[model samples]
Target: MRAVVFAYHNVGVRCIQVLLARGVDIALVVTHQDNPAETIWFDSVAALCAEHGIAVTTPEDPASAELDQQVRAIAPDFIFSFYYRHMLPVGLLAHARVGAFNMHGSLLPKYRGRVPINWAVLHGEQVTGATLHEMLAKPDAGAIIAQTSVPILPDDTAFQVFGKVVVAAEQTLWNVLPEMLAGRIPRLPNDLSKGSYFGGRKAEDGRIDWQQPAQAIYNLHRAVAPPYPGAFTVLGATTYVIGAARMARRTFADLPAGLAVVDNSIFGVGNDGQAIAIRTLTANGNTVTPEQLQQALIDNPH
Candidate 1:
């Protein structure tokens, strides 16, 4: 199956490798000309493409004249988008014989947007998954070809979930590519009513409001926690970045809500009418005990 693949980041390249190894003939690859995070390396894709001599383009827009010339020349049967950042234009879609497809990192009709895995964990959902669908002009609103769930255990992190989605995406591509390229792809329309959309979360969304339910606060923390911006709170003049934790009440007398019960976790009023706890935290270039933060409050009264 001849295809034009647009991708970004290491995960994108990994998925590309899986497709290529499965006998999909990749006509070209498109990504940012430069990467802000050094981690978004093309070494893997570059090496493979070099070995195979497949052309790569860093198109500002997939429909640009230069990009159009390349695609028109290759005339790929399909255009596979795996984490492509830009909203793909109709001009590009028209260039492919078999149409274009997207690999979304969520179970469609659920978390449908840029950061599905993060939003899923943040919303405290028990599970999420990967989906392969026909791309439409709208963001992530497309007919679904396949989906596979990844369980969201209590301890699961976005990073871990990201890994699961990667596995699901590669598997989905393998399972569906043959049918897709053959012009026999079987897909069902997404239930618009059933699907929900979420916007990208900012680093500020990590701010923990102590008044919120312990479970809700815990959910937000988990959603943005580590390998990410992480939850933070302005204590006096210092900004403390929160990490993982559970809900617990140490003592009614000494424990302060929204304060740490100990070195254990972030404190809150659980909906169950008990104290709450958060496990880890960092602040002012120092990782300290929750007690230290409390003492800071006692000393400075922020």
Candidate 2:
């Protein structure tokens, strides 16, 4: 089988590996150049393609006439997108002789838009998974081909959950590629009404709202922790990024909804009188220990 792949990140790398392992002739790989402003943490699809001697292009726009012509010239039997940032145009998708499919970070039709893993964690979803589906004009509103569920533990960070989703994407593609190559495509309904769609998140969205419930605040912290931007709150003139936090066993009823030091441990007192123990906190890229934070709170008890 012949294919043109549009991919990026670890999921892209692993899914491409699956295609290569299954003996698919990858005619071209379309990927993005790493944004210099963003942290480049994931495996590169371009690097993997180079190692395998596959043709690669880093196009600014996948829907351009130039790219459309290029894919049409290849006349690939299939087109697969794994974690590619851009949505392929309908014209571009039509270039594939068989079909074009995409791998999404969450099961359809839930978490249908951007940053599914993070959104799942933020919403305290116990389970979120990878979904392979046909590419349509609307983003992630396609018919499901395959899905593999994975657990989302209570304290699982977005980065950790993303690891599981990447593995799930690999397994889903690996298990279904042979059948797809044999022209036995699966088309399960992706009911849009039954699902939710979220817009892309910004770093500012990680601003912690102490007025929320303790679990909600903790979920926000987990959702954007570490590799994703850490959830943050302002204390006087300084901004403190919450690197890690968990619900406290006890409430601090007397404390206002904000940061507090209770028995030497830094806690976030929520509006519901519940507390969240701040495990790792930072300010200006420097770790701020409980003692330091306590002193700061004491110095500025506004």
Best by lDDT: 2
lDDT scores of the candidates, listed in order: 0.75, 0.93
The C-alpha stretches of model 2 lying farther than 4 A from their native spots are none
What is the C-alpha lDDT profile of model 1 across 72-115, one tens digit per residue? 78999888888877878878777888778888889998988878
lDDT of 2: 0.93
Q: What is the lDDT of residue 127 in candidate 1?
A: 84
Q: What lDDT tens digits, residue by residue, belong to model 2 across residues 97-137?
A: 99999999998999999999989999999999999999999
Instruction: At residue 268, give the lDDT of candidate 2.
Output: 90
Q: Estimate each model's TM-score.
A: 0.88, 0.98
Show the colliding residue pairs in model 1: 109-195, 245-279, 248-276, 248-277, 265-278, 266-277, 266-278
Clashes of each: 7, 0
Instruction: Write out the backbone clash pairs for model 2.
Output: none
